[model samples]
Target: MKNESDIISLRLLDQTDVVDDFMEWSLDENVSNFFTRGTFLTKKDAKRYITKFIVTHPWFRAICLNGKPIGYICVSPDVGSDRFKGEIGYVLSSKYWGKGIATKAVKMVAATIFVEWPHLVRLEGMVNIDNIRSQRVLEKAGFTREGVLRKYYIFKRKLSDLVMFSLLSTDQLT
Candidate 1:
């Protein structure tokens, strides 16, 4: 029998092909509550967001199961001198939470990101202090908790603390 991790995969987010599936999680308040962006109101808006942001993103992929998008993951590299590091982020449909899909996807990224961007030595993940589930995903994926940044930034109009986590290319992936 195939395990969830065995079937999980990542692929580029297609602007026109997965709008409805994208909206499944993008519009769900439970899924978008901790997201940096607001929930998209319509399919057109979702598609527009996909076209304008996701398609152009340097490293963004749809988290897939059985060849369909169930969530998304991305890594944003800093420009200029800080280009050696990148920040990772991911979101999953609420129905898929607790199934280990997020961790699998993150592990997949950890496994390949260094080769894909050889200059990158570090992959970081910053999670809102309140977002324990996401923090757990990073932990399970072999990220080391670096500590919390107090009053890191404003989230949803309120100042939020963020827990910083990182995995170095030299570190062994879980």
Candidate 2:
């Protein structure tokens, strides 16, 4: 575990130990709903996703706290239409919610993207309407809500609106 007080260490996702922890965390319903609509209902499903999302995609990373894989965040270039845009998403274990971990992790990722991937002109997220806590995290990390995407997503077997948000590298300015 890397002990950096106040801020959790963010690193590229790899290693069997972190994968084992991620598999367990992925099955938790509370953690699944906020980011991906509870689509990963079992450990096996999560492993398959981790294999493709984490293993194949070199840009994703495990969000670690005290040497434990508590959640994950990923950034990737937007394919087609908007080649200059990038998308980012994150999810944390239910136990870590309300503790500002997500916000911190997001800021770190944003900083990394702005610095390392300078060509990424826009970074965005589509958040479920009912996810107030997540909205707060995005705001705290400097994302501004752009608009409501009505019936943009289906979660838990029902249609739901999504809040679209983005942060530009220039947003750090006044």
Candidate 3:
């Protein structure tokens, strides 16, 4: 994995990945407000999510700062047309927002994906139109604003339009 900074690392996840802050952020409506999906109903639900699902994804990783998980980053390895293209998503505790944690993590993971998965050429990020902060994160991570996807998702009881951003292996951002 590419280390974004001395304090940040993208580390593999496991079943025992449960953390108190993770559970707390999962239940915080305000914290999850702009997420693409999910607001775990209970602490156990959040824990189960991390253990059973989060740890199983091929491209998922914990966003660690100083050895503590503050968020998660992942690419939907099975969603796109082929293994060469993937959609990415991430979630971080609100306390860490506005600090560039997500931006740095996105860049680090994107770099790793292009290098670690030799066949991969494109990485895409979809941000809810209302989620400007996340859009900025993608922009700062060397992704280009391709176009907007209308009525892209029905997540969390809200149907939303999204902006699509993409990064290609040929682009020189690093």
**TM-score of each model, paired residue for residue:** 0.94, 0.85, 0.88
Name the lDDT of candidate 1.
Answer: 0.90
Q: What clash pairs does model 3 have? A: none
- Candidate 2 has a TM-score of 0.85
On residues 82-148, what C-alpha lDDT tens digit does candidate 1 reach at each position?
6999999999988888888999899999999999999999899999999999999999999999999
Q: For residues 25-113, what per-residue lDDT tens digits would candidate 2 score against the true structure?
A: 66777776665635555556766766676789847888888767788888878888355788888888888888888888888988878
The residue ranges of model 2 lying beyond 4 angstroms of the native Cα positions read: 1-7, 18-20, 37-45
* lDDT, candidate 3, 1-174, per-residue tens: 234554977888654556565675576666678865568777678778777887777778888888788788898864546677888899888777888889999999877788887787888898888889899999999999999999988977867898999999888886
Task: Supply candidate 3's per-residue lDDT for 110.
Answer: 78
Candidate 2 residue-pair clash tally: 1
Q: Which is better, 1 or 3, measured by TM-score?
A: 1
Order the numbered candidates by lDDT, best leading. 1, 3, 2
| lDDT score, candidate 1, position 128 | 92
- lDDT at position 31, candidate 1: 83
Candidate 2 global Cα RMSD: 3.0
- Quote the lDDT for 168 in model 2: 90
